[model samples]
Target: MGLWATPTLAVLPSEQLKDPALEARARAVSAGLRCVVCQNQSIDDSDAPLAHDLRVLVRERIVAGDTDAQATQYLVDRYGHYVLLKPPFETATWLLWLGPALVLAGGAGGIVLWLRRRPTAVPALAADEEAEVARLLGDNR
Candidate 1:
């Protein structure tokens, strides 16, 4: 309703781990995971059923003695890097990390090439045109 309103979290009381530490870790992991259905919202924020499943999965992994990274990795293995809000920079993901910079460089190169090819000199006015201008000034006086 208001600007900057906090999102209603999709994390239900039933899904939370009994241990506060594990619940905190699960929430942290969920915050970094993208909801496959929602795409843009994190699993922690998305209300979709798939997001809820992923949230539960994260808690399950944490309670099963997996570290935060391992829990995140489990999802990543099953869902691929798309599940991570920030994917790792790897051979398979090099383009994702560098594509913007490549585009910017290409645009900059195009501008430089266009500048070099642009005509710089202004053509001089003809003698008759200059005389007509002088006559017009005389008439105005």
Candidate 2:
């Protein structure tokens, strides 16, 4: 099998944490960041150049004594809410989160209205036709 090629992280080697806890924190931070080149993938899973750079940035932040929330806020501040998979509940995002349920409710209401307006099936034929059938059967008894 051919050797797997790892993408080069852009930060200097001195920026990397020597301690295991900091390394874990760095990994956690990296996993939250979306790869700009691959919008659907987080930095941890993407091999794109931007993702490599983001991985390095995450490590750098951790080494610089930034907490996970602080590092995430730093990225979010730069990139805007589009980078987040789960955006916060705010006026701008309320429609994005609740639009589907509202649409479903509207559809259900339309169906109910249509059912109420539809005509009922009416029974056809006259009294003479009913008598003929009774004669054919000898009598109603």
Candidate 3:
């Protein structure tokens, strides 16, 4: 762990809010936001313009007297649930959360089908049908 040891928030000098408490709360909120630019990195750890904008937006919401939850919800309302690092389990995200499980179950069923042996010899032709064939062929040519 070196320069990357600490999460690199793109908080510019001019953008650092004066109130430490408010800034701390903003950072906490940012930690749960997914950076649209980085995709995988949290906004708290991204320097992308969108990440910076989101951070500022969170702070602005806090200063406007919105509670933390409200501020977060505001972002969600704007960006869709994809902006949240941990999206809630709901109809919209059921496929995202359960897609892999469904695929695995389907593959297992396929494998079981492939591994099973086929029916050996077409129902054995029935006992009477076998006797008829024998008589048609004669006792022994």
Candidate 4:
């Protein structure tokens, strides 16, 4: 593929609904759903068999007269919140959303504490050590 070439989508012509409006809705919903097999990709962008199945399922739900919310909820009901690309901020998902910030804050606090406790100055040499250094240098009065 050329450097600027866009990757082809997995949505085959046969999989698209006859109704354009419904197809658009299906695409929108597919964009929000994650591919179980390709965990990092949305169903719309993934070519995995599971992603194809999910794409078909979303289209089917849209054609069945389900509202966008209802269709999305149906998938959530079957697959749990993991299927959502952006999961809701609830008790179960709080850590997923907040864990990075919490870790960063902990790291920053540890660095601050270390800096505060570290030694800042060198101690002065004792009188005997200074006298020895002068004798070694052959200093005389």
Candidate 5:
């Protein structure tokens, strides 16, 4: 009844099973996989053929005795890390993880530089205005 559960199995007939445990594992793994075609969606929620293929591939690898990490690693290797819902923090991913902070720092530095270069406001008084102000304020002796 929730947004995540529509009871729709997009797998092939041969992929359906009565084993709840395998199905559960499949769901668990699939839910953490990103759909290459639909970047924002997990394979479980995607109806794309590539998503279905990835789902089947995951089930196949799991049934073949690959651990969850192994299966995920296989997908990551095959898809070049783009298939991972959560990319690992490594040298290759450092920029992706730190991009926002870097951008913010750069923006702050630019603002500071701009402020430093900005001209100071100087009040230019006309001859008459200057005399009036001097008279009202009592000119310094």
Candidate 6:
């Protein structure tokens, strides 16, 4: 352990790729990665420690001759599809992809059924009843 010893510290974006192209690629990949700690923020946008770690890992993989797809798949393999901001529309994510539309369609169908089954409007007062009531309670004689 000399003064030159590389400290076991987390990697930063500036400490990562030398090539701007690779950095751009990492940025693109990071943009699609969800921050597991900050569930609503992408790793590229999040300041969470785990997000920084993930961003560094992505840059490392890209620098180490892995394609963007390969690096992304590596993360996906480790974290499951939950790490992805947009999961594929498959069996696992079908509910997420279609739940809203299905709800809307069901609501529309329910409204149609209700409209069809509605009873016809009844008069507030029938013609004969209106006349009799007016006669009984005459206006100002």
Candidate 4's TM-score reads 0.63
lDDT of 6 by residue, 81-101 (tens): 898898879987899899999
Clashing pairs in 6: none
C-alpha-based local distance difference test score of model 6: 0.84
Give the per-residue Cα lDDT of candidate 3 at 105.
Answer: 97
Better model by lDDT: candidate 3 vs candidate 4 = 4
Q: After superposition, which runs of candidate 2 have C-alpha atoms over 4 Å from their true positions?
A: 1-25, 112-141
TM-score of 5: 0.59
lDDT of 3 by residue, 1-141 (tens): 544665554676577679989888888888899998799988877888888888888889999998989999998998888999998999988998999999999999998888686565666788999899999999784
Q: Which 10-residue span in candidate 5 carries the lowest summed lDDT?
A: 1-10
Off by more than 4 A, model 4: 1-7, 95-141
For residues 1-141, what per-residue lDDT tens digits would candidate 5 score against the true structure?
A: 543575665655576445778777888888889999999999977889999889899888888888888988898887887787888889999999999999999999999999989987877999999889889889572
User: 81-116, model 1: which lDDT tens digit per residue?
Assistant: 989999899999999899999999999999999998
lDDT of each structure?
A: 0.90, 0.77, 0.86, 0.89, 0.84, 0.84
lDDT of 3 at 116: 80
Count of clashing residue pairs in every prediction: 0, 0, 0, 0, 0, 0
Instruction: Write model 2 residue lDDT over 23-129, tens digit each, in one string.
Output: 77887777677777889877867767777777778878877888998888888998987766567789999998899999999999999999989887767768998
Question: Residue 116 error for model 3, in Å?
Answer: 25
Clashing pairs in 4: none
Q: List runs of model 1 lying over 4 Å from the truth.
A: 1-7, 98-141
Which runs in model 6 stand beyond 4 Å of their true positions? 1-13, 103-141
